[model samples]
Target: MSQAPTTMKASILAPGQIAPNILSSIVVFLVALPLCMGIAIASGVPPAAGLITGVIGGIVVGAFAGSPLLVSGPAAGLAVLVFELVRDHGLVALGPVVLLAGAMQLAAGLFKVGLWFRMVAPAVIHGMLAGIGILIVASQLHVMVDAKPLAGGLQNFGALPGRIWDVVTSKQGLEAGLLGLGVIAVMIGWEKFKPAKLKLVPGALLAIILATAIAQVAQLDVARVDLPANLFGSIEFVGSSGLAMLLDPTLLGIALAFAFIASAETLLSAAAVDSMHTGPRTKYDRELCAQGIGNMLCGAAGALPMTGVIVRSAANVQAGATSRLSTILHGTWLLGFVVLLPWLLRMAPIAALAGILVFTGFKMVNPKQLKELAHFGKGTLAVFLATALMIVATDLLMGVAAGIALSLLLMALRAAYLHVSLKKDEANKTAVLRLTGSATFLNVPRLSEVLDSVPDGTTVTVDMDKLRMIDHACLVLLQDWNRTAHARGCKLVVDWQALEALSEAGSKRGRVQGLTTT
Candidate 1:
């Protein structure tokens, strides 16, 4: 008797898998905890909000997300947006706007716009992520030194030198010293240690834990996060502005921005997860729905909006996580910490979080990948650099839009310049052209020009015997031309063998008919 298909299927979390998930979850929790607090404090929201979002993302999205390896949580990509929103609308007004943003995400998921993720060029996406990484490193510099985070992004970047000078001269030097040492240790450990080889130990987590323990034992007067104050601080679910704020146009605009950025990040991360999977493919629509639900729960619980984070997902994979159970376990650990070990969590050093982010930022800007983009074309590099610059100078959305627009324009120009001309024959009232080279959407304009410039009352015969490629765009153009010539009292004849040759050259695997001139 044959075994049932269900019985033959392999389980991602088979017996021994549970141990790795539990261990990886603990590592991810330690990694996420201080980051959650730091980003929230930096955004001017209560620190607990970030942790709350991480918990919700793990528990809610992790349980249902299509990508089993991806970890959902508060992303640094939204820091500038969150900070600007709070600055413009006041922290009190951010809650309702976040809720509205969650609803908008749900609506987008329902509309099946998740499929649009494929339309975005890979170059533009990489550029957006690289820019976000740079911004993260720059923004976290202040927090690493125990100084209050500055408001505007680029404008504040200019003050870093002066801030460093002040830190070097003041008594706060002791605190800065301890933080710097911790940052160095974390960075070195992450660079040198492989958790798999070490078993049950993540270098980043160990570095942070050791740093926090040392700080406590030495009785350092340096700045340390107060446990009780950081944890359980005043959290108001409904802000004073309430319903009116929900309907406010300005608030709506902010919420839309948040939703847009969050969705882009999540979708991009989901796409990455799809590429990493060796088994079955993930459903993007389902992933979007899960993200929407996760973000809504996050906002409702007084947390920042959540999204799938590539760094954490990569970490989960590196830690040998094979299923969503790892993500669920990570969230479970965070929840346990909030309930039972809030004090221990408060001992986390801000510098350690900064080190982790800095390491993550470095991974984002891979020189080898940039070199590969250069080989593709200058347009790819332009989009990548422009996006990176825009994110640094303005914001993520604006930068990404600018990069995409440039890429599209370049594609259009390339198409328009690719001409395919025909040689006229007055004796036989016929014209012939041997199409050669690749023809894509970029060549549509040239294809149109060649078709329109032919003299009236002539027989046009396109010989595609030498043509190497013809994409859908060129095929559509050819069909339209065939129709136009018939209506104009001219003749259009396409050879069947030639068409077959062209299709084979194009690798399109379709044959066209030999139609006589009308």
Candidate 2:
């Protein structure tokens, strides 16, 4: 009875699990509500679209999810990617891109390629998150004042200082800015000072609730959430334009990006959630399929793409979730709230949600991670900086691509890398050529030069034992040099057995001067 084969569904129905599941679901629902609407609003879609993603993520994905306690929903991680698509191609293209991305994820899960995402370098992941964070903060600053953000990340950043001054000096955007600021302050203060009894209550929920109340009490004129009375009214399914756009190369590329980023984020969140709870380990491929189902339904319903969200999942675990029942019930709560109290959601000032997102975006930067990255080495830190800065200066796809390229290049250099040195004891009539790094075809030329530098008619010892690795190319070169050394009356005192052993071990490992030192 391995844990992997255990069906969590049966466990969910156990009477012993009921009370904890209900309590955790309520906490998760509270955590997710603001984030769902906020992420959707940030992605330039209607408020209801986010809620739609939340419902599908909980009900559809939860039932099939491999990580029983993990929660899923619309996430800030993909907001920048979605916002760019909506800005350039119009809202119509979003559905098809999401639909196609979901299809790709589903196919990948079926093929069991979910584990391949684990190969993505940690530097690239952190860098990508940091980059996304910068973009979110830049864009949401405008939203905080009830204004549309500038076209791109750089543009938003460039205009940020002037916009802040405007909010301070003028009546135009002052009230909304103050409300957004208050929301941010409350969230920070609450997280730092909330009582032990209220620790399970999410700061985002409390902050937004207080902000919404203040807006009403003060009779504020700031913009409110634009949720519709009827949930179906907000959905605009994949139109003809969206369908046609799917065939276009640019949109297809976007879809592929969506699949890659979403899968990485989802699987990573599942892993994080698993660490938070001792109950079950994640069955990655199954969890991926659940995400696929959730995202597919979200796309069909004209909603935002969803991922296993760490925020709500953390809340679920901390609140005492026992099984997938808590995750599923959270979605039920979301649907109930949306259907019954659309007015309450609509009454929430848009600035409040924007403020929460801004705080979230700021947290994503995590400046403390810089020191940790630097601890690994300059190269690791370089990858982090390159990825983060490139995403800010250019775009998400290109930044990630650049980081991967640099990481691979460094790896290749390390594999084919070699160092050669010659030490001659002329008084003793002996010359020793030392090789101390990976010896492969890439290092052959330098190996030949060092061997040639040894004086003729002198006993030469090529120190093979010092070598980290040796491939066939270097071995053959050494054998050729051995023949020439003998012909030239120089005795080559090389331990062929040890050298051959190194080559055989490396070959068995299918490495031609690879990561394993032999």
Candidate 3:
């Protein structure tokens, strides 16, 4: 007798399986806590909003998630967009934008539009991540020194040198900077040399916890994580906004951008997580729907938008998470800490959070990714660099668009070479013009010249046997040339059988004099 489907699912979620998940959840929760607060503060939203997104992403999305081990939360990749939106439209307007973006993601998933995002070039994706990493590192460096960056990635970068000098030279600044550096040092050292059994303890969490403890014990005069006594007071419902703001082109653009990045990043992270674990593969469309719903809940509750996050997900897998229960439990832990242990959070130094994020940002610009691109080819490296630099100099959407365009351009150029050969059979008064390789609009003039040099009406046999591809423009040129040669009574003949399956028009014009496949 076989077990029922419901029974099988229940068995998978049994109490025995939950113990490891619960343990993993605690590890992920610790890893996610500082990141949630830091990313929110970085995005210029209240830290609690980030916690809210983490809760929704874990419990809400995890309940329905297809990638069992993958965790979701507010991503640093979306931080730049959030900052820009909050800067331009005010915090109150963000909820509406998030709500609309969530709706779009839901529609996209339902329509099976998730596959389209996978079409983006890998270089562009890596470059986007690298750019976000650079931005995060530059911006957080200022925060680590207890200062606010001016604005934008470029401005922050420009001011970095002066800020570093000021921070290192001051007594207060030196203490804060060193504390942040100490946190970074702990994370790095732990990663390089943690005991085999203790490896499950996430380095980021340990670093923050240790740093906080030391700061408290030493009575350091440093800025700490500031949370209101009533954490609920931080929730601001932005369900309604002015009609003009809702309809504003900028607002709509930002929403679309958010939706695209969130969806793409979530799917990518899910895919990555699946590679690390053999338990279950991701159902991308279902994951999208879950993410969409989670984001919607977050927006409704006036929290940050959420997506599948690689860092926490990887940590969950490393910590032995076997199912979505781990993710859900981690969110529970976050909620419990925020509601019941606000004092623990208040003890964390702001610079410590900044340092943790800076370390995360550095990891994002992974040397492995860059090296892989280099090994692929110069063109791949070029696209990667261009996309990364553009993203840093411009905004995220524009940089990706540029990288895609460049990739397409390179593909077209590589596929555009044409090989044309003409053989004259003087004895039979027949000239066989052999065309090979790609024939595009770019090579139309060369093809036209070859056709014109042919003596008028000498039984021209235009053979496309070696031809790989021909564009519509080149086909039209061939047709006009055929007509002219026919008018001259010089018999132009060609076979269309070779190209019939290649073009709709070619099949219809079978046995024509100068047939082309486009």
Best by lDDT: 2
Tens digit of per-residue lDDT, candidate 3, span 1-518: 12121111311776777787899999999889889999998888888889989988888899988677889998998887788788877888778888878888888888878878777788888888899899999888888888886677899999988888787566646666888999999999999999998988888889988889889999988888888776778877664453346688888888888888898888888878767755656788888888888887777777889889988988887777777888999999988889998888899888898898899889988978878898988888888889889988988888888888999987877688888877887777789888888888998888888887777557888888778777778877877877777676677686645554445466456636345543
Candidate 1 global CA lDDT score: 0.71
lDDT of 1 by residue, 316-411 (tens): 765667678888888888877876877776776666566556555656766667898999988889889998888789876688789889989988
- Tens-place lDDT per residue, model 2, 1-518, is 01222223424468877998899999999999999999999999998999999999998899999788889999899999999999998888888889888888898899999989878888998899999999999999999999999878999999988998887778777888888999899999998999999999899999899989999999999999999999977787876766787889999999899889898888888877766656568888988888887787788778999888778887887787778889999999999999999999998999999999999999988999899999999889999999999999999999999999999987898787788988998888798777887888998888888888888778987776668778899999988888877777788787887787678564565565565666
Stretches of model 2 off by over 4 angstroms after superposition? 1-13, 239-241, 421-426, 444-458, 466-468, 476-491, 496-518
User: Comparing 1 and 3 by TM-score, which wins?
Assistant: 3
Give, for candidate 2, the lowest lDDT window spanning 10 residues. 1-10
* 1 against 3, candidate with superior lDDT: 3
TM-score of decoy 1? 0.77
Name the weakest run of 10 consecutive residues (lDDT summed) in model 3.
1-10
Candidates sorted by TM-score, best first: 2, 3, 1
Clash statistics: count for each candidate: 1, 0, 1
- Candidate 1 stretches greater than 4 Å from native: 1-17, 171-174, 193-196, 226-234, 419-518
C-alpha lDDT score of every prediction, in listed order: 0.71, 0.87, 0.82
Cα RMSD, each candidate? 7.5, 4.6, 5.7
